[model samples]
Each structure stands twice: as structure tokens, then as C-alpha cells.
Target: MEKRDSMDAFGAVSLIGFAALIAFNQVVIAVVNEGLQPVFFAGLRSAGAILLIWLWMRFRRIPVMITRETIMPGLAIGAVFALEFVFLFMALDLTTVSRTSVIFYTMPVWLAIAAHFFVPGDRITPVKALGLALALAGTAWAILQRPDSGEVSLAGDLFALGGAICWAAIAFIAKATTLRNVTPHTQLLWQVGVSAPILLLAAPLFGDLVRDLQPIHLWGLAFQIVVVVSAGFLFWLWLLSIYPASGVASFSFLSPVFGVLFGWALLGEEVGPVIFGALALVALGLVLINRPARAQVPQKVA
Candidate 1:
């Protein structure tokens, strides 16, 4: 399919659905963390996802070969990817979904900052600067404010922040290194393939692999392997390939909103006024950051 310059109705609907899926995923992770140790669960997810990804590629006839140029960067991104999930999974385990979601979804803010330094032509415009300020403030606020009714932890918040940084670093590696030359499938394969063993080996140090093992947790792990890791991420990459990146990214703020809502509605996590205010600020900042610059009209000779 040809790339679109902007988001059409189909793209808009798809993005909304994707955002909701991701929001609900946070709740799923939190629940699944009950039966499995967080790091171990993440490792298992990565390990399972590798086989699924490989099968998908085989079915789609997408080559799985890694170029020599991309090998080092691929390994680097995979390591970073493992670290990202380790922090994120642990964050959800240690804190409320609402808090973790609000903080973890701050990935774009960190990505923007890194892009300014490393990604050529991706500078900090005035609008983006304002967006950064708002997002940073909101993130900080979300971290500092503790809810009266639900679980909150400084360690968990910091873990989420660290996850956000790792997420940004993965994006940076993709943008700044030879990894960008590879297919999305190959990039994903690298992440899961390399991270699986790293996560599994490291999982032992964190704790026993299993906790109060349950059927639902197994089901959740399957869901993560199939829906979230393989299909969900691929769907997102498909959208990015087709639609304008800025337009696609503009829908991201909805993830945290839906996340907070799902946490409140599903997990019965608290959503106080402070959290809502932080959400508002971050959402507004995301809008500003992703808002496209107006086109310049060429003037005729006067």
C-alpha cells in the first residue's frame, strides 16, 4: 500500500483501538505478575515471542537474515529491549497500573529529547520545547504525588522512568544506527531473539521463576506472546509505515488516558484529581509536540 501523508478515518480508528489495547495490556501485566515473577514473566514473554515472530515471518515470507552491519546495533537494541521490559514489568508489579502507565507512557518525551541530540534534522522547535516542558512537569508530578487509596512506590516510579528511558534508547538506536536499514520484522526478531536468553538468565537473579502459579497467568502469557508482542507491535509498525508518523504518534496520549481508566475500572486503582491533572498536562503536551508545522505558501513575485 502507498504511504499516506496524513491519517485517514481508518487510520484514526485503528490508532484508537491500538491505544486501548496497549492500555489494557498494562492491567494484564499487573495481573499476570501475581502468578509469575515480573522479570521471569518478561523473559518468558520474550522467549515465547521469538518463536511466534519467526513463524509470522515464515508465513509472510519475510527474510530473517541479519546483515553484518546491523548485527552490533541489533544486539545493542535487544539488550536495551530486555532492560526496558525488566523495568516495566517490575514497575507494574511494584505499583498501581495507573501510576505505572502514566509514567511509562512518557517514552515519547524522552525520545524527543534524545532525538534532538542524536537524530539529525529532528531539533527542538519552540512548540516541541513547550511540549517537553509540559510532559516533563506532568511526569514529575505523577511521580511525586501519591494517591491515598492505592499502592504507590518511589522505586516503582523510578523503574517506570527507567523503562521510558530504555524505550527511548531503542528508538534512538533505530533512528541513529544501521538498524534502521533492516525490516521491521528483522528489527523485532533481533529484539526478541537476543533478549530472550538474556532475560531468562537474569530472571533467576531476580527471584524464582514461578509464584502462585495459575491458569489465568498462563493464558495471560499466551496473550502477551500472541497479541501484545507479536501482533500488536506489528500492527503498530504497519500503521507507522502507512500513515504520517506525527499523526500516528499524536494518538499516543490516548494510551495513558485509557490506561488510567482501565486501571480504575478494571483493577479498581485510584484516580485522584492530581493524577487527572497530570494526565491533562501530558496529553496537551503530546498534542503540541506532535502537531504538524503549517505548510508555507510560496509567494508570487510582488
Candidate 2:
């Protein structure tokens, strides 16, 4: 199929659904953490995703070969991927879904900053600078707002921030390295394939592999393996293939909002003005950052 120049109705609806699915996934993680250790749960998700992704690749006839040049980056990205989910799961275990989502979804802000120094043809402009400032401030604001509730944890907030950084690094590697030569499916294969063993091996260092352990938790893990980790990611990559990347990315701001709502609605988590303010700033900042640069007007010749 040919790529569309802009998002249409189908794209808009699909993107919204995807955002909501991702936001709800945070709630699932929090629930699942009750029965399984955070790091162990993350490892299991990666381990399970490996088989699903491999099967999909085989079905689609997409080659999973990694060239010699991409091997270093493949390992690098996989290691970073492991670190990302470790922090994310740990954060969710220690903090409220609202707080984690608000901070974790700031991946684009960090990615833009990293790209400024690392990726060619990706220099930061004045508008992007403003966006960066706002997003960074929003992140700080989210981290600093502490209520009397026992649900909030400073360490958890920082872990969420770390997860966002690792997520940005993964995107940076995809953009700036030879890994870009491969299909998105192949790159995703690298992430899950390499991270599974590393995460599982490191899981014991975090804590025991299981908590009280329940069927709901087992179901949660299966949902993550099949829905969020495999199908959800593949759907996102499919969207990128069909729409302008920026246009597709513009909808990301919605995920945090949906996350906050889901946290409040599903888990009975509190949502306050401070978090709302942070969400507004972050969302606006993302909009600005992803906004296409204005076309330059030609000067009249003498």
C-alpha cells in the first residue's frame, strides 16, 4: 500500500485506539506487579514476546538476519531495551500509574535532545527549543509534586524518568545506526530477541521471581505478551508505514491523558491539579515539537 500524505479518519481512529491501549497497559502492569516481581514480570514479557514476534516474522516472510555491521547496534539496542522495561515495571510497582505514565511518556522530549547532538539533519530549531524547555519543565513539575498520599515515591518517579531516557536511546539508535537498514519487524526482533535472556538472568537480582501469584496476574502477563508487546507494537509500526511519522507521533500526547483517566477510573488513583497542569504542559509541548516547520518564503529577486 502507498503511504498517505496525511492522516485520515481511519488513521485518526486507529491512533486513538492505540493510545488508549497503551495507556491501559500501564494499569495492567500495576495489577500484574502484585503477583509477580516487577523485573521478573518484565523479563517474562520479553521472553514471551520473542516467540510471538518470531512467528509473525515467519508468517510474513520477513527475514530476521542481522548483518555484521548491525550486530554492535543490535546488542546495544537490546541492552537498552532491557533497561527500559526494568525501570518501567519497577516504577509501576512502586508508584501510581498516573505518575509513571506522565513521566514515562516524555520519550519524545528526551529523544529530540539526544537527536540534536547525535543524529544528522536533526538539529534543534528555536521552536523546538521552546518545546524542549516546556517538556523538561513539565517533567520536573511532575516529579516535584508530592502529596500526603503514600502512593507517590520519589525513587519510582526517577525510575520512570530513566525508562523514558532508555526509550529515547532506543529510538536514537534506530535513527542513527545501521540498524535502520533493517525492517521495523527485524529491529523489533532484535529488541525482544536480545533482551529476553539478559532480562531473565537479571530478574533474580531485583527480587524473587514471584509474589503471591494469581490467575489474574497470569492472564495479565499473557495479555502483555500477546497484545501490548506483540500486536500493539506491530500495529504502531504499521501506522508509521502508512502515515507521516510526525502526524502519527502527534497523537502520543493522548496516551498520558488516557493513562491518567484510566488510573483514576480503574484503580481509584487520585488525580490532582498539579498532575493535570503537568499533563497540559507536556501535551502542548509535544504538539509544538512535532509541529511541521513552516515553509520558507522566497525573497523577490531584484
lDDT of 2 by residue, 1-302 (tens): 68999899999999999999999999999999999998889889999999999999999998987899999999999999999999999999888999898899999999999988888878889998898888888889999987877778999999999999999999999889999888999889899988989989998898789899999999999999999989999999989989998899899899999999999999999999989989888888888888877779999999
Candidate 2: segments with Cα more than 4 A from true spot: 300-302
- TM-score on alpha carbons, each prediction: 0.97, 0.98
Full-model lDDT for every candidate: 0.90, 0.92
Model 2 TM-score on a 0 to 1 scale:
0.98
Q: How big is the positional error of residue 148 in model 2, measured in Å on the Cα after superposition? A: 2.2
Residue-wise C-alpha lDDT for candidate 1, range 149-238, written one tens digit per residue: 446888898999999899989988987999888788889999999899999999999888899989999999999999999999999998
**Candidate 2: clashing pairs of residues:** none
